[model samples]
Target: MTKAPHRRGADRTEAIMRTTLELGQEIGYARLSMEGVAARAGAGKQTIYRRWSSKGALLLDSLLSLHEPALDYPDTGDVVADLRTQIHAAVDLLAGPPFGPLFTALIGEAQYDPRVAAALNERLIAPQAAKTVERLQAARDRGQLSEAFDLDLAMAILSGPLYFQLLITQEPLTHAYVDRVLDALFTGLGPISRAAGR
Candidate 1:
């Protein structure tokens, strides 16, 4: 059976995005080109351009498509446990391939390209941060956190060590490390400990 026009377009878009990711991983983003992606994806250049104005835009979309479901915060009524589960999952993702290398490359690109930086923050970073903050807010409403708790600072504390491992030290983002970080952050924090009854 013949596919509908929209279906064909969707298929082509998926193919293009997939090709972009593959090329990005194999060749690195600096070497990746629109023409290369088009040739590999078996689509025309205008097809990619029509969908995304630049390579950074295309890559951001591709990573977001793959990274979205992995980063969702789960509410188990235990805030620390939920954060541990989600943060561990996120650390694992950052340690692996495709998402790992591509996301690292995108971050590097963002250092030089303001457009990519803005798009990354606006699209992936901000939304994910907002979701996390919302989860923390819900926990606070449950009396799991202090009313004056800095959710934003809590977020930074949650992510800081992992980013340091990912970018600076180049050490492994181990499960033990995550646990240690969580333990340290929550240690003797009355409200959080009281809520979990730990």
Candidate 2:
């Protein structure tokens, strides 16, 4: 049976996104082009252009699509542990092959391209930050975090160092590093009694 035109269009869009990420990983984002993606995806330039106006928009969607399925903010009763797990998972995702290099490229490109920056902020950064904020707010409501705890600062404290390691220092994002950072931040946020195991 022939697929409907809209269904076929959806399939083509998926193929384009998938091919874009694969090419981004192989050639690096600095060299990736919509023409290349269209060729690799088995779609015409017009098809890709119809869906995405620029490589930045297409690449942003590709990155978001790649990470969204695996991204989750855990709430395992222990806020500290949950945050650690989330951070560790994120580090693993961003430090591993394909995604690691791709994300690094995206960050670098974002520094110079306003379109990429805006797309990244809207599609990736804002959403993840909101999730972190939501988790911290939940912890506060449960008395795990003090009312005075600044959720925004907490989110930055959680993510900023990891990004620094990923982009600037190029240090290993280890479990120990995540734990140490979390411990230091939690120390200033107030102590939590684990007697009830929450």
Candidate 3:
């Protein structure tokens, strides 16, 4: 049976997003164009342009579609352990595969493109950061963190170093490095109970 028009459009959009990721992986975002994605997806350039006004917008949507499931903050009763697990998973995403290099490219694009910057923040960064903050707030509610804990500060502290290393220094986000960051953040600023140590 023929799919309805909207359903077919949705399917085509998915295919185009998938192609964006695959092409971004292969050629990197510097060389990825809507024309290339349309050619690869067997769709018209107008089709892609109709859905996304720019390469960054298309790549942002593609990254979100691939990454949303993998990036959820886990809650396993032990906030520290759960955060460790989630951060490690995040490091894996940032260091490996279709997400990492493409994300790096997207960040680079965002530096100069205000529209992409706004969309990236609203669509991806803000949502994911909110999830991390929610997880920490839950820990506070349960007394795993102090009532005085500055969760907003902690969130910035937790993520800032990682982003710095990833985007600026281009250093490795090793597990040990992540642990040290966690230990310093938890111990010095907001002291999660030593009992909560992994």
Query: What are the TM-scores, per candidate, against the unseen true structure?
Result: 0.83, 0.86, 0.87
Per-residue C-alpha lDDT of model 3 across residues 168-197, encoded as one tens digit per residue: 999887788899999888786555566876
- Backbone clashes for every candidate come to 0, 0, 0
lDDT (10s digit) by residue, model 2, range 64-95: 87557366788888889888888787777777
User: By lDDT, who's the top model here?
Assistant: 3
Error of 3 at 193 (Å): 11
> What lDDT does the true structure give each of the candidates?
0.82, 0.83, 0.85
Segments in model 2 whose C-alpha atoms lie over 4 Å from true places:
191-198
For model 1, residues 149-190, the per-residue Cα lDDT tens digits are: 788988888888888888888888788899999888776333
**Top model number, TM-score:** 3
What candidate 3 gets wrong by more than 4 Å, as runs, is: 190-198
Per-residue lDDT for 40 in model 3? 97
Clashing pairs in 2: none
The TM-score obtained by model 2 is 0.86
Worst 10 residues of 2 by lDDT: 189-198
